[model samples]
Structure formats: structure tokens, C-alpha cells
Target: MVYITEELVRRRAEHNECEIFSLEEVSLHQQDIEKIEHIDRWCRDLRILYLQNNLIPRIENLGRLKKLEYLNLALNNIEVIENLEGCESLQKLDLTVNFVGCLSSVESLQHNIHLRELFLVGNPCTEFEGYREYVVTSLPHLKCLDGTEITRSERIRAFQGLVEVKRRVWEQEKEYLRRRAKEKEEAHRKTTGEQERKGSKPGFDGRWYTDINNTVYVQCPGLEENKENQEAAENTKLKMTVPDLEEEQRREEEFWHTPCPFTPESRLEAHRHLEEKRKAKEKEEMKPKTPRTLITAEGRVMNVNEPKLEFSLTEDEENNAIVLDLAVYRHLDTSLIDVDVQPTYVRVQIKGKIFQIVLPAEVQPDSSSAQRSQTTGHLVLTMPRVEGEIKVTKGASRPARVCETGRSSSSEGQNRKGHVPERLEVDPSLHTAPDYANIVPRQRAKEGPLERARTPPAASSSSLSDGFEDDLDVPPLI
Candidate 1:
């Protein structure tokens, strides 16, 4: 049982130059065997493809190969041939012993003018009464059938039968065309007679003659005067009952107040309103905020609000999220603290000094302090609180007030002054600051005082590293 899939055969044919390709009896089973899809792309010179005794059900996939000359799809499970319309150069198609019930598939082979031999012996089409007559009439170029030499008597009988059928059909079609042409001619004659009768009468061509005495008629000129008289009578009658005509005229004038669509101030105002609403909605959706903290060297702590900035960042599936390299500087040391820091994506505080920093999806704050060292350099931390020893540079210049990376100039101005500006102008009550200790690096508690509590009087002289968690210091306020 050679269970060769289409993909496997295609991959093998891609590199090989075998002229005769055969997957027959190879246990291939598919309802839709696209010929070119299974064949190798490099098999441009393939001449004969034998896919018989397999499970191909449709023939549409074979139309792509322009050079195909011979195809055998016999004795498997084909139902119809709706897909073989483009095989223009096919010469020999073996479809014998299939379950095809209709002559439609055989008729579609008419476009395959090069087809010389077709096998349809065991199909339902072959057992159909007048089957030979139908095939001979539809496909006039077929020379061989059913793996045998068609006897002279059988050929003569089939040709004679088809000739009589064609003759009868031709007579019916000729009668139909003759009747249709006769009806069309009668209709055209009737139309011409009606036009001639109307043209024989006078006063219908915009010219009126006044017959004062029937013998001496004069052409009544001045058609404009008649129109004016009719209009004057209509106006007088309407004005006698309708006093609201003046109001109708006023409304019509108001309806047509503006002649040019582009020049109207109302149109411009509506357009401006739409543009403003669009910009506001986009700003609301795209504001970036984070909640990471920075530490200052002077020991004077300043909570920095990382303002939401705008930048085009694209994400990758393999990398999971977009990487942003934030440039941090230490004003005290004049050293740049550039790091790939994943922004903190959490609710932000509305305090004037602190802003929000919205990070990309799949990016989260470093939950463990031990894991912070492995973070990539593309990170911008929104510091909730800044404390001593570590000078956190927000902006580029001296005295680095905590600033977010990639913020605009207008937003930078807002962060410069102590009070934070409402760049996004989100509802103040909806924001919440993240836990600062979870994201920010804090100084570990000293062990000198706690060590005294852990050691007994005898063991105080011995060195002990266990029970370190309980030995950590406690704040005076706690």
C-alpha cells in the first residue's frame, strides 16, 4: 500500500525530471485532486500523468499545466468534470469505467480540440440510448473508443443516426427563426404606418393655422403671445384663492440659499466638527501610560509622571510585543542610563506630578526584582516615587526631572513645571497608581539589628546565615 500524498509526490517531482509520472494504484485518496497542486512546479516538461485507480473526484486542478498532452483518470471515483474547462491542449483523456451519468462532461471536452481518443465504455454515459450518436455529434474529432477498432458497420450506423437527428433539429431551428423574423417585420410595418398617418395631419408640428372661412386659412404667428395669455389666466385664477403663494416662494428661496456646496459656511462648520471629534477619539484610544519609578542621587525624591507619548510601534508574533529603547540619563554622573524597559501598564494616578504610561500588549512590569536585570533595553519606566542614591534622568538636560520617553514638545512643557498637565485628559477619578515596590528597585533592609534577635547568647558567637527573612528590619511607623 503506497500511500503517497499529493505533497510528497509534488516535492519529489520538484527536483526530478521524470517524463512519465504515475500515481496509479498508489493508494492516493482525495476528493479534490488539483493536478498542478500535486505535481511539482519544476515538472514543466511532464507529458503523461497517470492518476487512474486513485480517488480523485474532480478535474479542475489539471487546467493550469499548459503542456499537458495525455491524462488517464480511469476506474477510480470521478463524478463530474466541472474543472477541466481550461485543458485546451489535451489530446488523450482516459475516463473509462467511471460513474459519470451525464453527457455534460463529455460535451465540455469540445473545447479540448486536440482530444483524439476518449474511453467511456463502462460509464453510465456509454449505456445511455443513442450514446454513440450523442458522442459522435458532440465530439467530431474522436477516433478511438473502448480499446477496440470500431467496426465499419458500427461507424456507418452511428454516423447515419447522428445525421438524421441533426437534420431534424436543424429544421425546427430554421422554422423558429423564420417565424420570429416575420413577426418583427409586421411590427416594424405597423409602426411605420402609424407615423405616416400622424404626419399627414396638420397643426401637430408646432404650426397652427386659423381657418376663418376654411378656404382662406392664415398661419397664426406669435406662439409666445399664446403662451403668455395661458400663463396669465392661470396666475389670475390661482391668486384669487391662494394667498399663501408668497410664503411658498420664501421657503423655496430659503431651500436654494446656497448655490455652491463647497462655499457654504454651514458645510465648513459641520466638517470642522467631524474633524475635531475624530482627533479627540483617536487621542483617547492611543494614549500611552506606565507606572514605573525612578530614584534620584540627591536623596530628594520627586514622583515623575511618565506622560503618554505617540510613536508608530509594530508588534511581531515571534517576539510577542514591540520593543522600545528608552534613553535614561544620570544628571549627577553625566552618564546615559539607556535600558530596554518594558513599560508598566496599569491605572495611573491623577496627581499633578505623576502621569500615566500605557505600554504595548504582552508587555508587563518586572514583577520580581530578581528578574529586572534580564529585561530588554526598550523600556520606559513611569516612576511613582524617586528616592536617594539613584539619580533618575527623565529629560535630556541637567536636573533631570522624571520624563517619559518619546513624549511630544507640548507634553514636555507640562512635565517641566511641578504640576502634571492633563495630556490625555482622562477622567481623574478612574485612575489608580500601581504598587511601586513591585516594579521599582528598593534598598534591601540591613541585618545588623535583626541579627541580634535571631542568635541566642551561646550561638551569638557562632556564624549563622539561616533565618534571614525574619531578621530584616522593620520601619518605625509600622
Candidate 2:
């Protein structure tokens, strides 16, 4: 039921910069499209068209692709080789793994003199006796048949016996047609019997139900008198079925029909139909399945693979930051994604779909950063652990690295000059509060005038965790 809408065409043609008029190529494979439409009008300058692995029942609406050079219609429901006579520039045509039984349909390509290659492998017509000879004789210009080069000798032999080949091909075509007629009749009867069992009677419910919503009749002459009686109508005494169920029955009948495949992509097409029915049945059952909650009632973030994108999470002990590498689609735009970092977890919303995961350990949200790879489009998150945060001097009077006990900050954060700092472990029992106000100096006459007379703002105990050093000119408060 999926149609080739303007929005769909534009989205698929994003590589063409969303320009369909002058588009040269397009891939609309595996879209489950029941019919081919619009492309012939939308992309007139197209040279290559790939419509493979779909439910397309026929090859039409493509006669206008006069500039087309190669057309791929493999793995579809196409049963014939007609309607391609207008492709004046066609050089290659692929119709592999289809149900084309009428081998003589290959005669249509006689008009496409530019065609150099034609693929009819895995088709019912390929099984016919002297199928190669018939095609070779019909189209003397063909260079290859079913991937094999059509040698000059084969063409000469086919032309010499062209009279007998035509006679034999015609007899086989008639036999195939007779078998097809029986199949059509059987499919029609099976469908009719199923419909009879599904038919229902409309019972009294509303005046709208009895009249089938023909409100215009209510305004007509004699109908005005019946309106009063219709208002008091009841369904209690009638054999009334829910209107929704009746409507569903009508839809089901229209959904499952067999017209005898002119393009009998037999086994593969049946699989597609079964898959569609299973999905439809699941929707009708209305099963109540709750989505996985990213966060629990106890305020604990949970690990989840809801979107199931390929990803890898690892901890960098040397830098004390958890690095996450997510393999998002390289073509997906960064604008469609939103990232959120927390102490317990990281959440990413990619085009409205949420991908969340819990951290192995607590992290500092304020210090965390996220960036996307230019080449791979993989999202990389660097979350510095809270324990990895280090306190620095409250004043910029004397330049220095972090305290001997703390780790050095990155060059961008605070012009780091020293080597990578080693972790220092301290026993909690021996640790005590330090005199932050006296940590600097009470007198500094020997060191000349201070960088600023702006008395290093009184350091408060609460300033212990404030480590942001974006501005070097403004001294930090401890």
C-alpha cells in the first residue's frame, strides 16, 4: 500500500541534494511498493533506476525515462518485458529472479536497439526449450544472454533455424497460457467462498447506521417525517454487530486477494505477503506491551538498548573518563540528535528515538563533553569522573599547575604545562580539613607586587568542587 509520495522521493534523493528534476540515479529498493508511479514524471533526466526487491507488480510509468541507460527491476513481481520501448538510451536491462513465463515478451526489446545486455536468469521463461535461440534470433543486436556472451556462431545458428524455433516457442506459450487460466479460475473460486462466510447484516444502532450516513436524504421531502421515529431507535432488540468489526471484515476481504500472478515471483512474493499479514495481525490483537523505562522509580538510571544501535562503552582509567563510541548512521545529520549527560547515565535522542545507557561509575556532568566523528558519524562521549576533578589555586598571582595531590587539567581548560599527573591515594583516617585561607601566603613582599590588588576573594568551604577555568584573566575562587 505504500505509495511513492513527494516527501518519500525527496528523502530518498537526499544524496541528489533533494533535487528530483535533474536526478540521474535513485534507489527505491525494498520499499514494499505495490505499484510503480510518479518517478517517470518526477525524474525525467534519470539515467539509472533501481527498483529491486519490492512488490511492484508491473513495469509501467517508465516509458518517459528517455535518458535512462540502465534499469534494474530484479526480485519483483514483473511478469512481462513490455512498456520499455520508449527508453531510447537504454544499454542494459536486468529482470533477474522474476516470474516472467511468456518468453516471447523478450521481443519488446527489439525496439531498444541500444540494449547491449539483458538478464532473465531464474525466471520461468528461462526453462523453455531453445529459449536462448529464440532470444538470439529475435534480437540480433544482443551481445549477452543471462550473463553469458552471445557468440556470433550461436546467433548464426539461431537465424538459420529461426523458422522452427518460432513454431516450437509458440506451442509452449499456448500450453503455459492454458495452465495460467486454470490457476486464475481456482483463485477466483477460493476468493468467492471466503467472502460469503465473512458477509454480515447491518442491524439497528443509530439513524446514521440504517441510512448509512446519507445525511443529505434527511433534508429531502418525505424523509423529514421519518426523522422523529429514527431518533427513538434502539439496538437492544436487534442482531447488531459492532460497526468496527463489520468494517474490519470488509477491509480483510479487500486485503487478501489472488489475481493469479502475471509476474509470479512465486516463493519470495509469498514470503512478503505472509510478513505483511503477521504485522497486521499483531496490530489487531492490541497486545499491551510496556516500553522499557530508562529510569526507575527509585531514581536509578537503567541500561537499555531500545534503539539497538551498534555501540561500545569502555572506561579510560588513565584519563579517568568513560568513553562511549556509538555507531550511528553516517548519513544522519547532527541536527537530528540531542545529547544529555548525567552523573549516573547518558541519554541520546536520535531523530526522536531515545538511546540511553547507565554509566559503570558516577561521572561529572558539568565536565563531560560529546562530539561526532567527521568521517564515521560515530558519537563519542567523554565523561570525567567526579573523583577525577582537581582543585586549583584560587588566585592567578603566581602561575602554577594543580596541587601535588591533584591531577593536571587539560591545556584548553587552564594552560597545563606539566606532564600527565599520577594518581595519589590517601587514607581517609589520616585526612583532615586544610586552611584554605592560609594555603596562599599571609605576606608576599619578597615576590614583588601581586598580579592584582583584588584581594583573592575570600575562599569558602563550598568552593571546593568549583573547577571551571574558562577565563585565565579572572582568578578562580577556591
Candidate 3:
């Protein structure tokens, strides 16, 4: 089948009932794609679109197609399953032979009531032996899966098998009921005859029955029943059963059978270490602590409760780059006042939900030593900046800022600021982030906030789609 162009798609749109299109076997590389910005635009009325063996990379192109019902994206380099946010009509999706490895990426597709079939055959995600079963259990509507179809014959066979099983169960239940009723009748007749012979009320044979049927009996000496007392009547019998003792012993043995993986020497060492640690922890709890909170990389509370802000700058020998390491204090509070940044004077601003750390040009370096001299060569480096600080929220619940400033650059191309005027000055052996890495060009001040308020606001439904522009500059812990 031929891949549609803008002209071809325009011609097809005029034709009514043209609901399906196939663009198979086309070597549609990223560079070859000139005008298909979002392929869904051309196939807005499409019910099925076969884009098999095409060189599609991302799923952002399919996010706008609200009418998509069936899609075949097999043999693509797709790694993520996204952009199908509101395609409610999508019933079947063929993602076989793709690079996808995670099924949780499309777990939200379970919300689609018509999503009955999903083909993920050649993908490693579906190849996991337990994954298919897990998906089936989680998504109840997933009937036909993994390039397989549920036909009418197959459904009928399953129904018939279930009916046969149910019939056998009912027969067994009926037979059990009949046997129990027959035994009850025989026992009633024997007891009535014995009572007539004695001409008195029913007497126990010095035995107690645990179950109502009296199939199993136990003998307990000094056990007497008082007809007049209701509580004694209920309490006269022993509550022990055969299964109870066995289950109790099984639990006890299981509790004690848990093995500890430690040698005798290791055990002694562990005991000593544990005792020392316990004393240290108690002393830490009793000591006067700092007023700082530590925020982890994932924005959670620090396990240890003592407060201490530690900072370090490490140099990487391989990449010739420096890394900023800041520790967050364990104490989290709402009244957290200042974040201490050593060897630098930076103004910290907390405006609403956003926190900004401004680094002046005086304290920061212009460029690393390697980039000022050579065009294409290797170089080694020493370390600098032994401390830094990162602003964290009260409970370390969120990272207010991130600082990934120190990095090395290898640029063989010209700089962006016009021509190289005069000096051939370049440092080929220094390590630093790209020259423009931390630089944000100063912008002119606009009108007051009240004056700009008259304009329409940005759509709340729209997300910040650009990845690099996301607030990733702040470090959560110091």
C-alpha cells in the first residue's frame, strides 16, 4: 500500500465512507518526513489506520485523533506508549515487534470499554511469562490478546465446559444432602425408640459431639450438662478440632524456622555494631539538632530525624566534570527560614509555589579550562567548590530547586555570538558546563502585573510539553 501525501489525503477526504487507510512497507524515516507533522490530521475520520513497518518514533502524533478505533503500529521503534489520552473509540491496538518493555505505560487503556483486543506479540513486555496473566487479571475486558482472536466456536466451547463443571458440582451437592438426610432420619427413629423404652427425657451416652451431625464424638470426664442453665449448656463442650492443633503447630514451626544468614563471627560483630548504633541514635535524639530539613531525590522525608546540612563538590575523571552534592537536614518544619550556600552569595526568592536561586556573574566561572584553547583534543582536570546548598520544602516533600551546574563540554563548532572577531583564545584542557548552560539572557521589564492581567491566561489544561524547560534547576537538599 502507498503512504498518503498531503495531496493524496486531500483527494481522499472528499470521498465518503473512506474509513480505512494502509501505509505499509514504506521506509518512512525521520528525515524523509517533511509534512506529516501529526499524521492523525489526515485521517481524522479514520476507523483503522495501518502504519506497519513505518519509521515513527514518538506517540505525540496520535494524541489528537479522537475517532481512532483500530491502529497497527507494528515494527516501529516506539519505546513509550503515550498520546492516546482521549481516543475513547480506540478498540484494538497492534504494537507487536516494537521496542516497548513496560506494560504499565498503557495500563490506563483499561478505561476504554471497547478495548477487547491488544496485540503485543514480539515486544519483550508481553513476552514476560507472568505479564499476560497479570494484565488479564487487572483488565477484565481484555478478551482476545496477543494476536489471537476469540471466535464464536471458542466462546461456545468455553461455555459448554463451564456448564458441565457446574452440573457435576450440583450432582455432588445433591448426593451429599440425600445421604445427610437419610442418616438424620435413621438416628431420629433410633433415639425415639430408646426414649419410649426408658419413658424419660433424652440422656447423653457420656460423650460430646462437636458438630451438629454428631459424626465425630469426644469423651471428656466430669463434663455435665444442666438443662436449666443456658450458659453452662453452651460451655459444656470442648472447642478443640483436629485441624486447629495441626494449624497451630504449623504456624509455630514456621515462626521459629526462619533462618538467619549470619556466621558466628558475623553475629558477634553485628551485635556489637547494633549496640553501638543504638547508643549513637539515642545520643543523637537527645542532642541539640539543626533546624534544616533534608529532601531526597524523589522528594520524601529523610529516615533519620537529626538535622545536618552537608555539601560536597566531586570531580569526575572520565567525563572531566564536577558534581554538586548537597545534604538535607532531617528536621522538616514550615518555618524554615534560610538555605545556607557556602563560598557564594546568592539571593533566594520564594514566590508562591516557585523558588528561585540567582547566581551572580562575579562568583560563577565564565568557562572551564579545556574549552579556551583546542578544537579537538583530550584533557584532564582538578576539583573546585567544595560546598553548595539546595532549597527544600518543609517536610522535604518536594524539591524546590535543583543545581546541576558543573559539567564539561566538547564543542567542535563555532559559538553563537556572531563571528570570531580577533583573538584565537580557547582553553582546550579545562572542564566546565557548556558556556551557555547556566546563562539566561536578561529580558526587559514588561508592564505591571495588573496591566498584563487583562490578557487571556494560558490554558490550564495545556501542559508544559518541553522537557528541558521543566523546573529542574533546583536541588532539594543541602
- The best candidate by lDDT is 2
How would you order the candidates by lDDT, starting with the best? 2, 1, 3
Model 3 residue runs over 4 Å out of place are: 1-5, 8-36, 149-478
* Model 3 weakest lDDT span, ten residues long: 347-356
Error of 1 at 398 (Å): 99
Question: Whole-model Cα lDDT per candidate?
Answer: 0.50, 0.78, 0.48
Per-residue lDDT of candidate 3, residues 267-366 (tens digit): 3334434565588579879997564444457954332212233434455545433433333323323234233332232212122121222222123223
- In candidate 2, where is summed lDDT lowest over 10 consecutive residues? 206-215
Which candidate order results from sorting by TM-score in descending order? 2, 1, 3
Cα lDDT of model 1 by residue, 106-160, tens digit: 7788888888888886775564556666666677767766665555566667777
TM-score of each: 0.29, 0.52, 0.27
lDDT (C-alpha) at residue 38 in model 1: 44
